[model samples]
Target: MHVVAHTEQPLQAHALIRAAASQPALLPLAQQLTDQCWGLLPGVHRLRFALRGDVPQNTHPASPPLTRDRLSLTLCVGPHADWPEFAEVLRAHTTGACETPVELAALQARIVTIIGAGVAGAGTARALAERGWQVTVLDAGQAPAAGASGLPVGVVAPHTSHDDSGVSRLSRAGLRLMEQTMRELLIEGVDWGCTGVRERRLPGKTRRAGVPLSWLNEHAHTANDWTHKAPPPAPDDAFWHPRGAWLKPAPLVRALLAHPNIHWQGNAKVEALRFIPHEAHLSHASTNTARWQVLQGSTVLAESSRVVLAAGPGSAALIATATEDGSAPRINPLRGQISWGLMADLPSGAHMPATPVNGHGSFVHKLASPEGPAWYTGATYDRIHGDARLLDSDHAENLERLKALEPDTAAALAPLFATVGSDAPRVHGWAGVRCGVHDRLPMMGRVPHAPEGLYMNTAMGSRGLTLALLCGELLAAQWHGEPLPVEGRLAQFLSATRFRSNA
Candidate 1:
């Protein structure tokens, strides 16, 4: 069982006083409890107390072992304690673990239908499948990572702010979780590289001036690395993140969807959702069994009591249809294009930086590919453009931005441009549309007022590579009634209900 200790201000002392005043026989024990717990750290602690005559004192062999039950107490001893998060944790522990309808019929198998086969959908599939639920993922694309997640290499790093905003904290937590996941699932150095990242500050930006560099070092820096000192070849003002890395999303998505309980159906476009109520002849108890149907045009594609909409820009339309509310949160489609070139084209001793660098545009070092060693750089962002077709103009725009960001690297590639012409490098690139909510945060949790079984986990923008796994875990935790991996405030910030008028 869980209990929250009244450790705020005079509450601790007041509890002790009330206990002693009400029961004079327990005065000594109440005083001892106060002395032992009044100054503990701010975290969950286990407490045990022996009650007189609670167990027999006999030492017989057949006598049951001393019966002991552990009490989990959440202690907050400082003014900075997150009360809302503490309350949520307390609620989860006290209410027991297990979601509603899934546990209603314990003998029957549970099934969940997830739409979309990108990172978000694949990650959610893995989470649910690991919990013994049969999950089937449907996607309109021919294969997974056929959307924004199809990027060859994407950076995974924590965001930092002077005030440590919600986005920063969430990204920090997400980065840690992603790092742990990569270690467990993907092959090191091949599928992912923890080569660290360098963030170059703009010429006039001063938001991070007064912030202590130690904060970044403590949170994301390795033991051997120190903050405030730029590594060789990078600008002196560039901030280094030792824990940052570059990941290949396709492999990660495939690995996540490889679970035995997960099934994938490609080229299956989900057109609409329907909530089918139980028939009148069915028993009242079975009425609580929710049913959702996934439709493609007039054809029924799939159905289950649980459904998750994670199809990026396509989720907004589905949500609007499912909830029958046209005012659902708007997910904007933002087009992005990334340019790449063969690393062998550069001069043999060219000063190509070993790590990924982020400034006006980002550059990734040589990564092994089927063709040969390749380098990625310049993902031009255009919010007004929604077209998925690749453009030579966009590729040129990427190279231009890269030239401004790293002049030396651009100069070193002059030979390649001379040999193959500038247009050759611009032709090799990829383009995709990324989804973004109006608030610029991911939309997660149950769809607002839509049935209990309907949910969403999309609109991740460009951070899908960094935030998808953690958000998936968060959704799974809520669905299973498990302790959340992130704080309650962060979860609420990304909640689907945030778009509701009454919320």
Candidate 2:
């Protein structure tokens, strides 16, 4: 259910949301309304009330979810004057306030097949499963997170730009959503940590991106909790992200796939998709039926009325099979490598950062590794390279990048980098290939120029840990006509159709 409430008075709205506290029967539902709605601030805000297991009675759906058992609620706060604009947004997204379109309803079957078992696939599956869809996740690997989502530890900090760019704003939304999800599904210390990230925004001469060299942001003071200037002596370009985090992507993938409504099938490498357009035997009315058979070299792996390609780079191939023009998203592979080692092996007088840091690259320490307490650094980005092999040369590249990130820390770790032999336990390397487009934003929604049931949710790049869950939620929101998790303008930036050529 989606709701838009308009009022000049926010205190009244706040009080009404808290009204659930008055009824003992409604206490459980009260816990889900946990956002600092409106912040009691002037701007528009949104709060979610998502329930599972035991749900309370509320307003019935104006438009039902893909499955009729929709248990989610979204409240969009705005003024009465904005009704025209709000209504337009609803119409553009094809939300459920009106009768479902015949074509749209055909893709709403309760069963769905999701390609890949990484963060993108698992996140999409979880969102659909919660809405009562029986989701089958197929992965080419033997286990979840066997791709880029297998990164040992990655940061989930919001992107910060001086002007609060669209990507930055979308990242904030993703981070907020992730904060709630981590609390609900995963163990705090073991699976993830809200350990704040300290970003050393270096100069443009040293890196591809950075904060303003002069260090003044007109908007920082207002959103201080999200991003702000670091304290004195911490470099004028430096930043502090209080809500940032470091997470093990694999555990998150596992947790998302664990939903009872989601079934994960490993080693099911999808080679193609066969479209079967047939006529349905309707008792009351005749209808067109659309179904997709997931194939692996003529062998059917799974069949469903809807198929979503969250298969990272592999989605390009599957989309080709269903598109009449052989059109597919041009997602490129970006490979990155990180260096890590046991903390106990550090030489005397050597030091590691007290927290995670990023700018030129990223460095994280005190994280638990299989070799015991460990520190990680680097992650040199190599574009268009699908190779994920650990290389001594790449380790050197990481150390060089880390020097630009943290000079003292890099200097201290030089000994370990210099002595890393085949059997060396002091230093190690891990590499993985991530996918992205030229714009750096992800491509999602239903695939353009393809069959109706085909969807793409890949190209997260290095921000997979930061953006995957939000992309998944956005994909679900679009399909179900639910209130979008982010603004409409920001959502449009992620659409793959933006890349389509015009005459």
Error of 2 at 329 (Å): 2.1
For model 2, what is the error of residue 186's alpha carbon versus the real structure, in angstroms, after optimal superposition?
0.9
Question: How far out, in Å, is residue 215 in model 2?
Answer: 13
lDDT per residue for candidate 2 within 235-258, as digits (tens), equals 676778878898989999999999
Ten-residue stretch with the least lDDT total in model 1: 39-48
Off by over 4 Å in 2: 1-46, 49-56, 59-104, 205-222, 279-288, 422-425
Candidate 1 error regions (>4 Å)? 1-109, 204-233, 284-288, 414-427, 500-503
C-alpha lDDT of candidate 1 relative to the true structure: 0.70
lDDT of 2: 0.76
lDDT scores for all predictions?
Answer: 0.70, 0.76
TM-score of each: 0.77, 0.86
